[model samples]
Target: MKLLILGGTEFVGRAVVEAALGRGWEVTVFHRGRHAPPAGVRSLHGDRTTGPEGLAALATGSWDAVVDTWSGAPSAVRDAARLLADRVGRYAYVSSRSVYSWPPAAGLAEDGPLVEGSPDAGDVPYAESKMGGELAATAAFGAERTLHVRAGLIIGPYENIGRLPWWLGRVARGGTVLAPGPRSLPLQYVDARDLAEWTLDAVAAGLSGPYNLVSPPGHTTMGELLDACVRVTGADVELRWAEPEAVLAAGLEPWSELPVWLPPGEMYDAMHTADVSRAVAAGLRCRPVEETVADTWAWLESIGGVAPRRPDRPEVGLSPEREADFLAKYDPAGGDR
Candidate 1:
């Protein structure tokens, strides 16, 4: 099978490319050519943001499946779908859980109400635009010919985005690490390789429509997540529960620049937990979190994926009283304590 991937150089895309190649599928990638293509993979380069040049490059050939890990903007995806609708047998768009509405209630299903037109959604147009892209792709190729993979917090090897790595690095240092307060927070992440492998399998099975690709059952909560990280890194780090605001004031950023922090908010709440029965039923088998954590750390060590050092400024340790006060104000429920 000839599989063409859009945006095949970065974390998730690279994983998909690797998975596809491992399955002995003929894979071709289309990107801006800024980064080097994976060794021995066919590549065509052009900008997707500007015009039809990139679409033109892809117009020349046909494939059994086109997995688009990039192109979240509605217009770009719409155009690409129009261009390749007749050529490709299946179109898979990698979307995010962000497409769901905030404060997702328990057991949010694949057919749950999605976020409508919101300007703020365009801030990270990729996630926001994906909602529209899903509609457009489904409309163009029919629901049976398109697959929308709404992935959760993707964590695994070669994750340079500093989401999981920040926590891992801080914990490995064996220092007082700041963490979110409790709320029985549901945390779910899919290993990139697993996601990639599932995408390939879905294509092969001619699977279509939307599916939430997330961690399996009993794979929720922040404490378990931290424990897994500790086991992987062999770090005995002490965690200091602090207010989200205090952490921000201390120069920490949210995993993603979303509006909410505590559980049951926007981003976290939507993915605090998601039912993955459909994906599993479709042959999606994720690696154990322990294995994921260990593999991620091993990859980071090999690539020196340490957080860059900030300029040494005057130490600004929070006083015990002040820290306690901040924790009280923010973590009033005291779940993370």
Candidate 2:
């Protein structure tokens, strides 16, 4: 098999590249060259945001399949899909579950209504951008040849989004860590490597259309996840598990300040309870959360204990001052340790 990946130098894209290589497939990475792709694949340098001319390097080659992980503008996806429609045999767009309409109900599946988007749109919000990218891919490749990987909460090595890395780093600090409670609160996420492997298999099997790509709900709970982190990092921290009400009332934000945490409510239900039956039935197997956490810590240590941050995304996790203040004011387990 031969594969071409756009933006193949980091995060999910990098995972796809590595997974393809591990399968003994020939791989080509079309990227901006800001970071180096893995050693084995062919590299083509271009900036898709610069429009058509910047894509000159991509004009000459063809691949059995092309995986695009563009998240910024829909027009970029449109342009690339159009350019490669004839040359590439299959198109796989790494789309997000965020394309679902606002306040997606718990257990929403691939058939859920999507947000509005157009192939020609530019500089839109993340949800619309992904929706438009999906539209653009199918528009160019036809539904039979296009695969939409509607991924939710991707976390693993080479993660530039800073979710798991923040937890690992915070745990390494070894103090009273603000662990969100109702410890059994489940989470839905996919290890990028797992997502990559499944995508390659799906494309090879001629699978098309949107698949809600995530682990089954309750693959791991909040406590299990954090406990793994503490175990891996060998932190001597006390997990001050605070209730959702107390955490929110203390002016902390979910997802942003607290990273992977979402308070129990509509957002949590929407995010952590997606129906991934389609993906699971289609050969999606997630690694244990402990493995994910441990490997991520190992990777972080290799990279000097600091994870790279995407310029496009805002930084996550609570500041030391804010966390200290919150811990000082309210400890659900009683006064203070």
Candidate 3:
């Protein structure tokens, strides 16, 4: 199989490139040359955001499938899809669950109502950009020939977002850590490698249309995740699990501040609770949380214990002083300290 991946140097894109190579498939990566892609594939240098001149290098390649992970303006996706539409047999766009309308109801599936977007749109919000990318891909490749991978919280090796990396770093610090609660709060996420593998398999099987790509609901609980972190790092850290109300009252946000944690409410339901039955039936499998945590920690350690974060994303995790202050006033056992 011949595959072309745009932005194949980091995160989900990197995972797909590696996965393709692992399957002994011919892979070609079209990236900006910012960071080196994996060693084996053919690499083409270009900046997709810079318009046609930047994409001149990609003018002549043909592949069985093309996977694009662009999260910026829809125009970039539109441009690439149109250029490759004639030569590439299928198009796969790595979209997000965020494309669903705000406050998506629990168990929302691939058919859920989506945010408004356009194929020719310029720079816009994340959700709009993703929806527009979907529109753009479909507009160029047709719905039957385009695959929309609507992914949820993606974490694993090569994670540039710093969610798991932040937790691992904080736990590795060996002190009292502010663990979000309720500890039993469930999480839903997909390992990038797993998503990549499923994507390739789906493409091979000639499947198209949007698939809510993530593990089943409650794939792992907050307690399980943090406990795995504590175990993996072997750091003498105490996970002081705090209540949802107290954590929010402390002015700490859910996803950005704590990372991968949402209080038990509508927001949590929207983010973590989704119906991925279509994907599961299509052969999606997730690794155990322990494996995901352990592998991510090992990857972080390999890269000098610091995760590369995307410039477009805001910083995640709690500040040391802020966590300390919150710990000082709140008692994990029950009441105020």
Candidate 4:
């Protein structure tokens, strides 16, 4: 199979390229030279933000599939899809559940309403841009030829987003780690490799439509996830469970600074609780959480930490000072640890 992947050198895109290579598919990656393409894949350099001339290199070749991981402007996505409509058999756009309206309720189905409208390539909002990408793909390739892989928080190796890495790093640090509670808080995420393999298989099988690509709900809890982190990293640590309200009261932000954590009774509680039965039935198998944790920890150790890679400023994950202050005060009501 001849596959074309846009932005195939980072996180989720990298996983897809690797998975496709393992399957012995002919993969060509079209991306800006910000990063090198994987060793074996053919690389074409171009900026998606540029107009016709930017995409001119891709105009000549045909591909069996195109997997787009674009998170910016709908116009760019529309132009690309329009260009590739006749050149590719399938267009798989990696969209996020954020494309759905916020405060998603429990048991939200894939058929639920999606965000609408186009966005400027510059000054693009993440959610609206994704929604625009979906529309662009469908509009150009038509429903029969497009697949929208709507994913939730993607985890596993090479994840630079700092969600899983932050957890793994914090847990590996040992001693009085403040964990978000209740400990049973359900979390859902899919390994990037799993999503890639499933997406490829679906394309090959002529499967089309939106699939909520996340691990099945209740597959693991926050506590179980942390335990896996500790086991994989061999941390001689004790996790001090902090109630969500308490953590919030202590001035800790949910999801951003905490990474992969959400407070109870918050509207975002439903973000991680999305229904993913369709993807599972369609052969989306997830590896063990421990495996994901272990491999990710190994990658972190090899890189020597996130700071070097993100030198300008590490965006996600809490600061040591902030964590120390929160840990120093044990009681949610403001007592000492």
Model 3 lDDT per residue over 1-337, tens place: 9999998999999999999999999999999999999999999999888887779988997999999999999999999999999999999999999999988999999888999999899999999999999999999999999999999999999899999999999999989999988888889999999999999999999999999999998789999999999999999988888899999988998999899999989999988999999999999999999999999999999989999999989899999999999999997677777
- Stretches > 4 Å off in candidate 2: 333-337
Q: After the best TM-score superposition of candidate 4, give how far the Cα of residue 226 lies from its true spot, in angstroms.
A: 1.1
Query: What are the per-residue Cα lDDT tens digits for candidate 4 across 4-58?
Result: 9998998889999999999999999999889887899999989877766789878
* Colliding residue pairs in candidate 2: none
Query: Considering only N, C-alpha and C atoms within 3 Å, which residue pairs clash in candidate 4?
Result: none
Tens digits of per-residue lDDT for model 2, 1-337 = 9899998899999999999999999999999989999999999999999998889999897789999999988999999999999999999999999999989999999999889999999999999999999999999999999999999999999999999999999999999998988799899999999999999999899999999998998799999999999999999999988998888888899999998889888999778889999999999999999999999999999999999999889999999999999888985666534
Give the lowest summed-lDDT range of ten residues in model 1: 308-317
RMSD of each: 5.7, 1.3, 0.8, 2.2
Regions of candidate 4 where Cα sits further than 4 Å from its true position: 119-122, 307-314, 332-337
Q: Which residue pairs in candidate 3 have backbone atoms (N, alpha carbon, C) closer than 3 angstroms, thus clashing?
A: none
Highest TM-score scorer: 3
What is candidate 2's local distance difference test score?
0.93
The TM-score, computed over Cα atoms with residue i paired to residue i, of candidate 3 is 0.99
Better of 2 and 3 by TM-score: 3
lDDT of 1 by residue, 15-58 (tens): 99988888888999999886776786899887777655557788
Best by lDDT: 3
> What TM-score, over all chains together, does every model reach?
0.81, 0.98, 0.99, 0.94
